[model samples]
Target: MTPAPALTLARRQALINRTDMAGPGRLRLVNAAGQSLVSIELDQPCGTVDATGVALTDTEFAQVTTTGEVAGALLEDAAGERLATFTAGLASTIPAPELPLPAAQLYAGAFVRLIGAHIVCD
Candidate 1:
C-alpha cells in the first residue's frame, strides 16, 4: 500500500474553485440528526483561497429555526446542493482550525452570526 500525497496549496485552491463555481454559497448549521438549525447565505464567490485555505466572508445574522446541539455544518451551493460537510462546535470545542460557532446550544428564533471562519485545508 502507498500513502496518498498531500494536497498543495494550489491544488486545494483548485478544489475550492470547483466547489464554489456556482457562485455564492450557503452554510447550513445542522444537528446530530442532520436537521437544519439555520441557513446563512454566503457572499457571492463565497470566499478567497489562499495560504490559509478558503477564507469565508463574514455573514449576516440568520435566525435559528430548530433547537439542538450543533454537530456539524453543510456547505451548499446557492441552489441548496450539498458541496461539503465539516465538524462544528463552539469556538473552544471544535477541533478544526476554523468553523466555530458562538455556542453549541441553539434555540429557535435565536440569531446566529458567522465571522472570521475558514475552510482550512491541511
Candidate 2:
C-alpha cells in the first residue's frame, strides 16, 4: 500500500481544555500546512525518551530512539505491529506513523510534549 504523504511537525502546542483539568487532555500533531497529521484519541501516554517505552492496549508499544540531543518514538498498533516512527528532525531516517490508530492511541502527543512550545510564559 502507498503511504500517506508525511507532514512536518508544526508547533507542538497541543490543545488542552481548561475544563478537563481533572483528567489528562488530548494531544495531536499539526502539520506545516496547519492540518492535523493524525486523529489521536486519549489514552495513557505511551511515549518516552528514556530507556523504557510505554506499553499501549493489548500488545501495542512505542520504541524510543536518541541522537544525543533529539529523541523519537516508533509507534506500534495493538496486536504488536510496526506502524511508524517520529524522529525529532535529527537527520535520521524514521518515517511518520500511518493515520488513525485503533480507537485510541498515544504516541505523538506523549512524545511531542517532551519538545513542547519552547517558549515559557514566565
Candidate 3:
C-alpha cells in the first residue's frame, strides 16, 4: 500500500492560517439529521495557528435552538462559508477531537459551551 503523504509543520500552519484569516468564524453543532442545534460565533481572529494546528478560542454559551443527539460539527467562516466538518463524540472517546460535548443529548432553550477545540491538519 502507498504510504499517505505527510505535511510539514509549516504546511499545516499555512493551511490553518488561511482558514483563520476568515476570522470570527462560526461553530455549529448539529444532530444526526444534519439540523443545527446550536450556533456560536467564534472569537475574533478565531484561533492561533502553530505546528500542531489551530487551537480555537473558547466560546461563550450559545442557546440551543433544537434538541437532539450531536452527531457532527461544522465550521464556517465569517461569511457563513463552510471551512470544515468534524466528527462529534464524547471527550473520553477521542484525542485532539472536535465537538466533544459534555453530553450527547441537548435540549432546546438550554445553553452549550465549546471549550478547548483544536483542529489539526493531518
Task: Output the number of the lDDT-best candidate.
Answer: 1
True-structure RMSD, every candidate: 3.0, 15.6, 3.4
Can you write out model 1's per-residue Cα lDDT over 93-112, one digit (the tens) per residue? Answer: 72653466677889999997
How many steric clashes between backbone atoms does each model show? Answer: 0, 0, 0
* lDDT (10s digit) by residue, model 3, range 31-64: 8889999998887666766555567778888999
Q: Following a full C-alpha superposition, what root-mean-square deviation does model 1 have from the true structure?
A: 3.0
Question: How far out, in Å, is residue 62 in model 2?
Answer: 17
C-alpha RMSD between model 3 and the true structure: 3.4
Q: Each model's TM-score?
A: 0.79, 0.24, 0.76
lDDT of each: 0.76, 0.28, 0.74
Using lDDT as the measure, name the better of candidate 1 and candidate 3. 1
The residue pairs found clashing in candidate 1 are: none
